[model samples]
Target: MAETSEARASASAPGGDAGGEDDKHDERMLECNICLDTARDAVVSMCGHLFCWPCLHQWLETRPSRQVCPVCKAAISRDKVIPLYGRGNTKQEDPRNKVPPRPAGQRTEPENTSGFPGFGFGEGFHMSFGIGAFPFGVFTSTFNFGDPRPSAAPRGTAQYDEEQFLSKIFLWVAILFVLWLIFA
Candidate 1:
């Protein structure tokens, strides 16, 4: 037992060439099972196999009915795989295109328990009504009065442009209606 322990210590000494070679071997172990190349977008299965996310995604897509690790045949899915982050990785590539993005790490804040001491139930309740005939109702409908409407879409988006165009059309229609009411 003493001789075996001494032999193990000598083999793993910090300054040995064998130690450097062991590092290279460890790196090789991280290579993707499917591509037989160093994994990019690395993810590890629950069964303890490493893979590139894109390669695994394609594999899973190809065999939708049987999602399993290529190496161990253990049950695997996108959510089941844990992403591996390394110090050498620096470039931030967009994960959104063509493939599902890696899951973001979840964070949760502690709940706030303090009650609203100054506020009453009446403050939460708001009710309003409008009583008028057809013309008045049309004018009121033209302008939203109570319960603030949602803000317009952010600028430079398709939804914003469509909303702007629709608002202009409605404005013109409202003007025409008001003019017709006055003249007739």
Candidate 2:
């Protein structure tokens, strides 16, 4: 009776031969579906299929439009899959070194704003209307009310010089046209 009981105890112990078989089965479960080898940088799909990150990345790139699990044919995406980090895993090789790294977990946070939140369309509204031919329409006056015009560019800059040169040219043209109207 004692011999039989000791035999039963030894067989069921975690350090026994049965435990080695269980470890092998667990390792097999972690094998990649694509390569049929032990998974490195393992990720599990939503459909519960295991794969190495490199294997899945290539599979995804092969058919970018139709991403599905190699095993179950269920819908899978990089973002939808979850990375598996075993207790024994050490940080040796970085996942980012691979062509396409494992997808990062999604995170969302509430927005924070410094000023008034709503749209500012109501406060500063303005409109202008003009009716003239194409070439002579340059003489038309532009009107503004609530909408503030942008400040002129700083002095000595290229934009400032260009604006000054154009303003003088337009002034001379306007004076010549007014004189022609009076003398004609």
Candidate 3:
């Protein structure tokens, strides 16, 4: 009966106390020992001493097979580091909540299109539109029949004039036409 009355009195108090909240906030701000920079990605050792991920990674890089924590001085042999990503830092989505469908313009490649089993495009007549090289070491010739000149010759090969070739073909065609007219 006495405990119930005390709880009711505390609940009825206005605005609660301010000093208690401030001390909790101050305890959350952790500082790294190495480099003395504010930790973005945190890693905590078994001794409960915290250090920034980058700072600890660099320290481990040059050391021998056995690695030790700078704060607790404990031996760390296996490649295991405890992450300090608290629940307050991460926003988790509930599994029961349904995500809305994205607009057409916002749609990207399918997430299931990874390199797992039954993942890639199958071998068939229908091929995906992509940039590919010709098989059997093939090279394409850039020849324009309308211009009456073959643009296949490389720039460094020889002197290439489109007008000269077109005129030559025209002269031969004219002679053939005259011959055909006379024979008819």
Candidate 4:
């Protein structure tokens, strides 16, 4: 079945269907036989077979003195190995292969900052009063003059330790004062 179709197609064509010729033409185009990695500068052996340079070097290094070429099996001398830069017409296997590291001047600048404006670490104020939530915005009577509201406190109850709070406030104030003296 296949031969009949090939014969009919060949008879219909002028120069015996040029597909095979195209395949040979394409073969001469660069191709990597080792990793099948195609690229410009693909290494070519003295026997006229091609493979990527790094791939060929790695292969030879591992099995030195192995005269048989991997692709053609033609006898190859160890020194006949040649480097290829960018010859032949095969596309690189991985188009996005790693590029050489750029110099400092060519490197992209790092980002300076991230996130929303007018915000700093540990400095945020949010008040939400919706259904299924606490129904209150901050209302402090102690900070301003107001009638003393009735409060719940059992007898002999003690408030939070004042010493620790005072100490922390004093420490921060002292640090800030020192900084202000220097900067002002």
lDDT digits (tens) for residues 127-159 of candidate 3:
122234532111111122233232433334332
Best by lDDT: 1
Candidate 1 runs further than 4 Å off: 1-17, 91-98, 101-184
* lDDT, candidate 2, at 89: 76
lDDT of 4 by residue, 32-126 (tens): 77764354445567888877656665666666657578888887644576654343435644321332322333477889774665433222222
State the lDDT at 12 in candidate 1.
69
Local distance difference test values of all predictions, in order: 0.70, 0.68, 0.51, 0.51
What TM-score, to 2 decimals, does candidate 1 have? Answer: 0.41
Better of 2 and 4 by TM-score: 2
Worst 10 residues of 1 by lDDT: 121-130
Query: How close is every model to the real structure, measured as TM-score?
Result: 0.41, 0.41, 0.32, 0.30
Ranking by lDDT: 1, 2, 3, 4
Order the candidate numbers by TM-score, best to worst. Answer: 2, 1, 3, 4
| Whole-model alpha-carbon lDDT for candidate 1 | 0.70
lDDT-best of 1 and 2: 1
- Superposition error at 58 for model 3 (Å): 0.8
Q: Model 2 over residues 70-93: C-alpha lDDT tens digits?
A: 998998877888777777878655
Q: Is candidate 1 or candidate 3 better by lDDT?
A: 1
Candidate 2 steric clashes: 0
Candidate 4 has an lDDT of 0.51
